[model samples]
Target: MTTATGPDLRERAETVLATLAGPGARLREDQWVAVQALVEGRRRALVVQRTGWGKSAVYFVATALLREAGAGPTVIVSPLLALMRNQIDAAERAGIRAATVNSANTGDWERTYTAVDAGEVDVLLVSPERLNNPDFRDRVLPRLTASAGMLVVDEAHCVSDWGHDFRPDYRRLRQLIAELPAGIPVLATTATANDRVVVDVTEQLGLGRHDSGDTLVLRGSLDRESLRLSAVRLATPAQRLGWLAEHLDALPGAGIVYTLTIAAAEEVAEFLRERGHPVASYTGKTDPAERLAAEGDLLANRVKALVATSALGMGFDKPDLGFVVHLGAPASPVAYYQQIGRAGRAVERAEVVLLPGREDRDIWAYFASLAFPPEPLVRQTLAVLGDEPLSTAAIETRVDLSRTRLEMLLKVLDSDGAARRVKGGWVTTGQEWVYDRERHQRIAEAREVEQQAMLDYIGTTECRMQFLRRQLDDPAPERCGRCDTCTTPAWSTDVDAGTAAAAQERITRPGIEVAPRKQWPSGMAELGVPVSGRIPAAELAAPGRVIGRLSDIGWGTRLRELVDGTDPDDAPVPKDVLDACVRVLAGWGWEERPVGVVGVGSRTRPHQLDHLARRIADIGRLPLLGTLAPTGPRPEEHANSAQRLAAVWSAFEPPAFGMPAGPVLLVDDVVDTGWTATVAARLLRHAGATAVLPFALAQKG
Candidate 1:
C-alpha cells in the first residue's frame, strides 16, 4: 500500500473515476477536496452539493483507497432502499464490492453479514431505521463501528428536523456516531439541505463540541446547469392534468411525474396511459416488488415517465433523467428542490415545472398532523404495557394512534429509551420521557415558513435557480440564464377547450367503493368486545359506494368545502351533490336495489345525512325506515381502527321503524375507518334486515 496524501489520492481517484465515467473522466476541484478530507486528512466532512455532482464518487473512491491501505469496509447509512441499490451498482462499476441491508431484503442480511465480517465487502449500506433495531444495534453495529474504515451518511439532511423530509429513525444516527471510535472519518452528503439543515447536519457530524472545529463543511451553489425551471399556475387540477396528458411525451427524455398524493399519482398515470404514453404509478403504498420494477423501467427508459410520490424522492440514480413535473406543488421549496433533483443530473438539459394546486395545503396539513404524539397519548401508551409485553395490535386497543403514527411514536420512544421492541412485541423500559412542546412548535412553525417560501418560489418573477440557491444559503448565488424568468417562458400556458372539457367530465364522474371490513380488529376481547377474527360472511355488510373520497382532486374539492362547514345554517345538500349521488345510484349495478333507506344519525351534519337519505328514498320510491338512534353519547373520534371499532360497537341502536323486508341503505356524511358502517350493518342485521348496504357523501380514504 502507498502512503495516503492529497496528490497520491487524487491520481488514484482519477483512475477510479475514469473506470466509472469513461476513460477521459477527471475529478472536479471540489470533489477532490471532499475526497482528500475523508482519506488523507481523516476528518469528518459535510458535502452539500447539487445532485449529480459526484458526491458518491468521493465516498466510493475514498473507501477504495482506505481499504487498499488495509482499513475495514466503509459503512454507509443511506435513507432509502433505492439509494442503497443504486450505490451498490455504482460501487461495482468502480471495481469496489458493496452490499446492502434493508427491510426489503432481510433474507440476504445474514449472508451479507458473513461477507462483511470476512472482509469480502468494500462498502456496506444500511438504512437509518436499521440503527435502532435491537438485533442490529446490539449485535452488528458495535462490531462495524470498531473496525469501519469510513462512515458515509447519504441524504444526511434527514438527520435534521429542519429538513423537509425528516424521519425520527435518522436521529438515532447521532448515537451511532457517538459510539464510533474517534477520527473514523465520516462523510455526510445531501443535495437539498437549506442553511438550517446544513447547520444541524454539521453539528451531528462534529460528534462533540471539541471536534466541531475539525469538521469540514463544503457547500456548493445549488444551481443545476442542465435544469430549466418553470412554474404554471393553473386554475383547476383538470387543466393541469390536461396539460400533462397533451405534452408529457414531448419532454426531452424519460423522467418522473411527481404527485403530492398516492391517488393523484395513480390517477395521473392512468390518464397518461390512456393518452398512449408509457407510464407507471409508484407510491409508498405500492408493493416493494412493483416499486423495484417501476424503478427498473424508468432506469432503462422502457417507460416514458413514472407518476410518483416522494417515495421516489431521493437517492434514485438515473444519469440522464430529462424532466420532472409536479402535478401539485410540494409544501416547501426545499422539498421541491429535492424532488426535482431527480432530473437533469447528467443530461445537458432537463425541464422542471410545477403546477401549483388549490388542494396542496390540505395534503400538507394531513401530513403535519403526523408529527410527534402528544405527551398524554405517549404516557397512556407507556401505562398500557405492564409486566407482560404487548404487540402493537394489543396496544392499539388501549391507545388511539394509527398503525403508522403509532409505529413512528414507538420508534421515538425506543430512541428515548422509554420502550424496547423485542421479538413478540414491545415492553416498557420505565424511562422518563420529556414532551418537547417548544421543539414541536418550532418544527410546525418552520413548516409554515417553508410552505410560504414554496408559494413565493412558484409566484416569483426572479431567477428560479437563484431563488433556490439563496434558500440554501449558497455563498455566491446568481441567476442561471436558463429558467423561465431569465429566458423566455417557452412552454404553452393554455389547455385547449376540448381537452379541458373532457378533463372536467372525467374528473366530475365519481363513485368510489366503500369496502366493508371483512375481519374484526385483533385484541377486541381485551376491549370487552367479544368479537375476534373474521366477521361471519352472513353478518358482513355488502360492498358499498361513496360519491367520492375527500382526498381526491375532483368531487373532493366540493366535498371538502361542504363537509368542513360547521354552520347550522348550511344548506341541507347542494343540488350538484344530490345529482352526483343520484348518478352513483343510477350506475351502482347493485345485486339488489335497496328496499328502504335509513340514516346513520350524526352528532354533526345530521341534516346532511337525513336529507340525502330522504331524497334517495323519494327518488327511488322506497319507504323511509327512519334513522338509527345513538344509544348514548358518542365517544370522541377514535384514533385507530381498534379504538374506533370498540367505541362504535355499542354506539348505535337499531332503527326505531324496524328493518325493511329487504336490504336497507345506510347513509352518513362520511365513512372514515368504515367501522361505523360495519357496526351499524350488524345492528341492522340483528334488527332482522335481510342485508345492509352503506352510502356516504364522501370517504376518508
Candidate 2:
C-alpha cells in the first residue's frame, strides 16, 4: 500500500489522530495509507472494508489532510440522521468542530443559507432531502463553490436503483457534483456495492478515466463464523407461532422478530408477550416515543425481542443480539441480509431462523405488485398530463380513481419524474420522466413468474454455498461450507409440497365461476367485526373477499386476480361491504379461486362467522388494535422488505469499535416475494460485504 510519510501529509494525519485518540496518538497503518492517498490528491478512491473495519477512521484522516492542505471546507452527504449524529458526536468527542444540517435541525431557510454562505461550519453533514431545498441550492451550495474542498457521498449505493436503497433524489446528486469546481476530489463510500453499482457510481459522479484497480476495491468473504444459519418449514400458522414460542426461551441477549406486515408484527409481539416473552413492536406506524422507547429497550437489554416490520435495524448499533427470527419470508434477500445483519454484532455466536410458508409469498407478491405501476398506467398517466399542473382532484377525475389511489400513483410517477407536482397539483414533465418503463415492468412481472426460482435456490437439495455463489455471481471458491442450503440434502421431490398441495386444492376445487368484481362497499354484518371494517373495498376486491375473510380467520390466502371476463365500467360494490365480506369469507375457509369473482358465497366453508368474531376479539386486546387493522395487511407491511433493503443501501451506521462482526441476513416472506430483495442483496454483497444470507418464511411448492 502507498504510504504518505511526507511531512505535510504526516502532520495532517497526526493532527487528526491527536484529536481522535485524546492524549498520545499513533496512526494505524490503514489510517496512514488513507491520509497519504488524500494528500496525493487522488480524485477517486474506494475503501472496501468489512464491518468494524475503521472505514470512518480513513475518512476522518482524509478530512484532516484536506484541512492541513488549506482546502476550504468539506461536505459529507449522509443518508440517515443517526449516522450524521454519530459522526458529529465523534467529532465533538475529538474536540474537532463539526456541524450537521438536516430536516430536523434546519430551522429556517435564511439561517441555513447564512450558515453555509458564511462558512460557519468546517465539516457539514447533510441528508439528500435537504439538498433539494431551494435555499440550499441557491445559497448554500453556491458558497461552497469558492471553498469546496472535498465532497463525500456516504452510503453511495443509494444512487443506483439496482441498489437496496433506491432514492429518486439520490439520482439527482450528479447535478450537485457537477456544480463543484474542477479538480475537487470526490470520495464515495458504501458498505456494499456490486460491479454494476460501482460502475454506475463512477460514471454518475463524472469521475472519468479513473483506474478501476486503483479504486482500492476491498473484497470481503460473506462468511459469518459467529452466526448459525437455520430454517424451519411452517406447514401452518399455528406451527410457525409454536416454533417462535418454543425458540423464544433459547434466545439470549437482544432479539428481533421480522414479520411480513404490521398485523403480523403486532400479532407476533402480542403472542410472545402473552407467552411471557418480553417483547415490543416496531413499525413505520410506531410513534416517535414508542419507536424510541422500543429501540432504547432493545439497546439497553430491557426488551428481549422486538417484533418489527423491517424498520428496527437501520442506524441501530446494538452488537450483541443473540437471534433474529423471520416470522415470515422477508420480501427479498437484501431485506433478509439487513435484518440478519442486526444480530451477532458483538462477536458472540448468534442464530437466525427463517420460518417459511405460502402466506409469506402471498404477502410479498401483493407488495411487489405495488412497487412498480403497470406500464400502461404509466404511459397513460404521462399522456394525459403533458406538462400542465392539475389539481389532485382533477387528476383523479381524469384517471377515474378515488383521491387516495390517485395520490399514490402520482407519488410513484413523481419519484420517477414522469410527473411533478406544482402548487395546484401534479403534472407530467415529459416522457423522459418514465425511467426504463419496459425494464421496470419486466422486473415486476418477473417477480410473479419467478416466485419459485429463489425459493428453489434457497431450499435446493444442492450445495447451498454453491447456489448463493451462482446467484451472486461470486468468482471465489466454488463452495461455501456453511449455510443450511449447503448442508441440507437437496430434496428431489417438491420442496414446498405442503404449500403447493394447499394451493392446488384451492385451484382445482369445484365452484361457481363468477365475473370479475370491481370495487365495492362493506355490509353491516361483515362490518360488525371490529377489525374487519377498517379496510377499504379496493383491497377486498383485488385479493377478493374469500381470501380476506380467510386471512381474518388466520388461514393464509395467496389470491391473485385472473385478468378476464370483467366489465371495466361495472359499478363497484360499496368499499366497506366488500372489505367486510372478504374478512368474513376469509374466516370461513373459502379457498381463494384463481379467477376473479364478483358476488359473495362462491365457496363458503363451515363456521366462518364464528372464526371471524373470535379473530376480532383476539385482535381487540392488542395495543396496535386501533393503530393497525387486523383484517388486512398494513400499508407499511407492503413495503417492509423493500424498506429494510433500502435501509442497508442508504443508511450507513458504523459499528462501534470492539464490536463483533455479524453476517447480514435478508429476510422476506417468499422467494417469489419480489425482485426487490434479489436486486437489493446483489447490490449489498457486491458493495464489499462479508456475507449475505437470505431467509424466507415459505416458498411456493
Candidate 3:
C-alpha cells in the first residue's frame, strides 16, 4: 500500500486511466489537476467540463489512489440508476470494485452493504434520494460518512434551484457534507452548470458556506469538436417527422431522437417502426426493466434510435453515440446543451439537429406552471399541517393543490426544515419557513430567459455552437465552423412528399384510452364524500376512449387550439374533429354500444359541450338522455383528487325522470382530473342507468 503524492500521483492516475479507458489512455492536464487536488491536497473541487472530458476519470483515479493508501471506500452520490451502473462498470475496468444501493436493486442491498462494511468494495454509489431515506440517513449514511475516503457528487447542478434540472433531494447533500470529517476530499462534477449554478453548487460544496475558500472550481471550454450542430425549420410537426423518417438512417451513426412528451416519444417511436426503423420509446413512465433493455439496445446499436423524453437527459453513457435529433426544442438552452452533449462523446463527428416546433413554447408553459406555488398556497399548506404524521394523500385532501404540486411543495418544505417526512407520511417540524419569493421569482425569470434563448438559438443566423456555449457562460466561446450557420448544413433538410404523408397519417391517427378511476381518492370521507376506497362495481364507469390526449403531437395541437385558443362563446365542433371523434367511437371495442348520450354540464365550454353531446348522439342515432345539471359553479380548478372529488361530489344533479335503462355515453369537452366524469357517472348509475361509458374530446396529459 502506497500513498499517491506529487509525481507519484500522476503516475498512479495514468495507470488507473489506462486501465479504465485503454492501454494508450493518459490523464488530461485538468483531469490530473482534479485528481491531485483530491488525492494530495485533500480539497473540495467542482469540475465543470464538456461531456467527454473525463470527469469520471478524475474521481475513479482518486478512488484508486485513496484506496491504495488504505483509505475507506469512495462514496459517490449519483442521481440516476443508469449512471450508477455505468460508473460501476467503469470502476471495475480499472480493477476498482464498486457497488450501488438504489431503488432498482433493493434485493442486492444487504449484500452490497456487507461488502462495503467489510472493505471489499472500493466504490459505493448511492442515489441522491437515498440520502434522505430514514434507514439510510439514520443508519447507513453516518457509517459511510465516518469511513468514506472521498465523496463525489455527479450532476451536481441539481443541488441548485437555479439549475435547469433541480431536485430537492440533492439539497440533503449539504447536510451530509457538513457532517463529514474536516479535510475530506469532495468532488462535484457536471457538464451543464452555468456560472449561476456553479456559484450555488460551490457554496453547497464549501461546507455549506458561500464564502468558503477551500473549494476549487475547474471550468473548461464547452465546445464539442465532434458535434456538427444544425437546426431544421419545418412548416409542421409532420414535416419534421417526415424528415426523420427519410434521414434518420442516413445520419452518422446510431443515436437518440428526443421528444418533449411521453405521448410524442411513443408516437415517434411507433411511427419510425412503421417506417421500418429499429427504435424504442423511453420515458419516465417506461418500466424500469424496459428502460434498461432499451438502454442496452441503444448501446449495442441494435436499434437505430431510442425516441425519448427528458427522462433520458442525464446519466446515459454511450461514447460513440452518433447523433441527436430533437423533434421539439427543449425549454432552455442550457438544458438543450446538456441533452445534445450525450452525443459526439467519442465519435469523430456526430450530427446534432433541432427541429423547433410551433408547440415548443406551449410545452414550456406547461412545465412552468409546475414551478413553486404562490406564497398564499404555501401558507395554506402550513396551516393544514401539524406535528402529526399525515400521508401526502391526506394532505392533498386538505390542500387545494394537485398531487404532483403537493409533493413538490412538501419536498421544498422538508428541505427548508418546515416539515419532515417520516415512515408513514410527513410531519410538521414547527420550524419557521420563509417563502423565498424573490428567489423563486428570480428562478422563474431565469427560466423565461432560458426559453427565449432557446427560441433565439433556433432562429439565430449566428454560429449555433457559439450561441449555446455563451448561454452556458463558457469563458472561451468561439464560432464553430461546423455548425449550419457557420457552414452549410451537413445533411439535407428535405422531407419527401410520400414520407410526409405517411408521417401525417400516423400522427393524425387518434384515440387514447381514458382509464377509469377504480378507487376513490383517499380521505374523500374526510371531505364529506361517502366514498373512501374503490368505487363499487355497480357504480364504476366503464373504461372509455378520448379522441386523443392533449399532449398528442397531432390531434393534441388542434385540440389545444380548440380548447385554449377559442373564445368563451359556444360553437359547434369542427367537422374534422367531429369526424375524428366518430372514428374513435367506431373503433372502441366496447362490450355493449351506448344506447343514449348524457352530457356533463361545463362552465367553460357549455355550448361546445352541449353541441358535442348532441352531435355524438345524433351521429350514433342514440337518444339524447339530457345533460346533468350543475349544482354549483365548476369545482375549484387544478384541485387534487380528493379535493376535486369532494367539490364535484354533489355538484351534478341527474335528471329526475326518463332514466336510461341501458348504457349511456357520458360526454364532456375535456377530462382533466377525470373526477368530474367519475362523479357524473356515479350519479347516472344511481339514477337507474345500467352502465355509463365516458367519452371526451381529449384527456389532459
Candidate 4:
C-alpha cells in the first residue's frame, strides 16, 4: 500500500510504455505493480504470468524509468539465443540502447564492453552461459554487478533445479544476485513455473537477504482462452506423420510443429516437404545462419511450420502464431505448456494438438542416462584435470566422455566451484564436491511423475486446458469449453489407408550409413595409449550400414526391443531383420562386393551376429572367413570411445584364412561409438584382409 510517491515517475512510465507496446497500449494492473516495485521501491519481485501477458513490458518500462534517473544499464540474464534476440529488439523499441554478449558475437565483445563502461548501453542482454566465461566472470562482470541498476532474469523458471528446463548455467545466478549491491531492484519472470519451481526460484532470488517476506510475488492463473487444446492418441508413428501431412495446412496459421528428437524433426520436415508443405527443420544442431532464416520464415508466415525440437521454445515472440502441433508429447506438462504458449498470443483462437507416440518413453530414457555423470566418472575427470589448464581436446583423450557430455559436466562443475575454466581450457579447483544424490533422485522422481501426468493428459476425457493449468498448480473453476473433450471432436480419427501405408514405407525403408572413425581420439597419450593422429586410410573400415537409428520410429523400435531384452531367448536375429540386411546389401552399391564374411563374435548377441553373417555369406556365395573371436567379454556398450577402444584393443583375433587377401564383411548387432568396429577392423586388416566393411542391424545415434 506504499505510494509510488513521485508524480514524474508515473508520467514517464506511461510514455515509455506507450513506445514499447503500441502507442495506444497501457500497462495491465500487475505490469504497473512490477514496474513500480522496481523503479520506486527498488524491491525484488517475481512475476509468473502466461506468455504474451506483457512480462517484457514490465522490465522495458523499468529500464526506461531507471535510466531516466541516471542509473547504470539493466542487466538481463536471458537463457537462449532466440530469447536474447527478441529482448534486444524490445529494448530498442523502448528507445533504450541494448547490446548482447554471447557466444554468437565474439568479435563484438570489445565494443559492447566499451559501450557498457562508457554508460552508453541502457539495457544489456546476456545469456546465462556467458556468466561462466572466464573473461566475463573475472573482468567484465564485477564492474557490471557493482554498477547495475537492476537485474532482470527472463525465463526465471530455469533458475530452479526443480523446473522442467533446469540448466546448470542458470544456477550461477544465485552467486550473481548475492554480489549485487543492496536494494538494487531485481525482477524474475517466467511463464511455465509450477508452485515448486516458483518457491525454489523465489528462494534463489532472496539469497542475499535474511527475509523474503518483502519480495513481491505476483502469481496469476494459467488460463489461455485463446488456445483450443486437443490430443489424438495415434497408434503408430506412421499414422501420426500421415495425419500431419494431410491435416497440417488445415490448421489456422503459420506456427510450429514440435517433435521429440532432432532426427524426428528432420524426418517430419522432410516428409512434409515431400508432400508439398513449405516447412523447415530447426534443432540444436542447426547452423546459426539456417536457424535465423528458419525463424524469419515462420515469422513472415512464408512457411506453414518450422518442424522443430525444444530449441524453438522460450521467448520467441510472434503475436499472431496460429497453431501448434506436436508429433510426440514432451516429457513434462510444464514444458508442453511453455511450447504451446507460442500459439494464439494475439489472436482470438489458435489450434493446438498433440499426437502422442508409443516410442517417446524410450527416447526419454536415453536422455535420462545423460544426467550428472556418476561420482566415479566425475572424480576421474578431476584427477586428469591438473593445476595446469588443459584444453577440452586434450582432456577428451584422457577422459572417456563425449564432447557434448564432457562440456555439460564441465559447466556443472564450474558452477559448483570444483572446476574452473581459465585462459587455456579447464582446471580443477581442488575443492570438495558432494554428489547430492538425494536431490537428483528427487528430481528424477519428479520427472517420472510429470511424464505420467503427460500420459494422463493424453488419456483424460476431462478438460485439456484445465488439466494443464492444474499441472502448473493453477486452478480452473470450470472446464475450458473449446478443447476436444469439452466440445464435439472436430477432426477425423483415422488417416487414409494409402497415406498411412506410404508413410510407414518411408520410415521403414531404412539404410543409415555408419561412418568409420577417421581420426583417433585425442589425449590417448594421457591414458597410456600411444596411438594418436589420423587413422590410416588402409586400416580404417569403410562406411558401413545399419537398418536404422535406434531413435528412429520404424526399424529402430524393433531394434531397441531386441537389444534391450532381459531373456536369453531373444539372442538370434529375427528373419525379417535378416531379410532387411539382405535388402541393405542389395541396395548399398559398394565399390567391390565383400569376398568373405567375418562376424565380430559377440559375448552378448552372439547368435544374432553369427546367424546374420552366415546368411549373408550363403546368399552372396562369399567365403565364410568365420568369426573374430574375443579374448574376453566385449566392452561395455555404454562406455565412451576411448574406454571402448582400450577394452577392445588386442581383444579381437580374426581367424587366419591363409588365402589371397580380399575385402571382408564384419557383422555386429549394433554400431554405437564405432570404436569397437575400429579396433575389430584393425585386427581383421592385420590378419590379412585388404579392407573391412562393418555392418550392424542398428545405429545408436
| Worst 10 contiguous positions by lDDT, candidate 2 | 594-603
User: How displaced is residue 486 in candidate 4, in Å?
Assistant: 0.9
Model 1 spans > 4 angstroms off: 1-3, 204-206, 209-211, 385-387, 475-477, 660-662
Q: lDDT tens digits, residues 219-263, model 3?
A: 898898998999999999899999999998889779999999999
Top candidate when judged by TM-score against the true structure? 3
Better of 2 and 3 by lDDT: 3
Please state every model's RMSD to the true fold in angstroms.
2.2, 16.6, 1.7, 2.5
lDDT of 1 by residue, 1-701 (tens): 35467677688888888877778999889989888888877888888888888899899888888998888999999988888888988899999999999998899999999999899999999998898787998889999999899899988888777788777787677777777786688889998787778777777554434236667778877777899999888899889888888788779999999998887787778777877899999999999999999999999999999999899978888889999999888988888888888788788999998888989889889988887788899889988876577899999999999998898888778777788877678898888878889988898899998889988998899998888877777744467999999988968879888777777777778787877899999999988899999998768898889888887877778988888755667568989999999998889898887889888987777777778889999998988889988777767788899999988888987667867578988888788899999999998887877888898888875
lDDT at 281 for candidate 2? 91
Listed in order, each prediction's TM-score against the native is: 0.95, 0.64, 0.97, 0.95
User: What's the CA RMSD of model 3 in angstroms?
Assistant: 1.7
The residue pairs found clashing in candidate 4 are 397-522, 397-523
Instruction: List candidate 2 segments past 4 Å from native.
Output: 1-39, 46-50, 106-113, 144-147, 204-218, 383-438, 441-453, 461-701
What tens-digit string does per-residue lDDT give for candidate 4 at 1-701?
13234666776788898898778887788888889989888988989999989898999999888887778899999988888899889888889899998999999999999999999999889999888888899999999999898999999988777887778788778778888988789999999898888888887665333235677888887888899998987789899999999999899989999998888888889888988999999999999899999999999999999999999988688989999999888989999999999899899999999998889888887877777777788888988888999988787766778777888888888877899999999999999988888988988899899999999999999999889999999989999999999999767868999889888988888687888999887667666767889998778888899888888866778888776645476456778877888888888888887888888887776777788888889988987888878777655544466666666666776665553488888888888788888988887787787888998888886
Candidate 2 positional error at 421, Å: 5.9
lDDT of 2 by residue, 109-220 (tens): 4665566567665677878776555456555767765577777887776776555565555655676777777666667776555555566666655555335544444334
TM-score of 1: 0.95
Top candidate when judged by lDDT against the true structure: 3
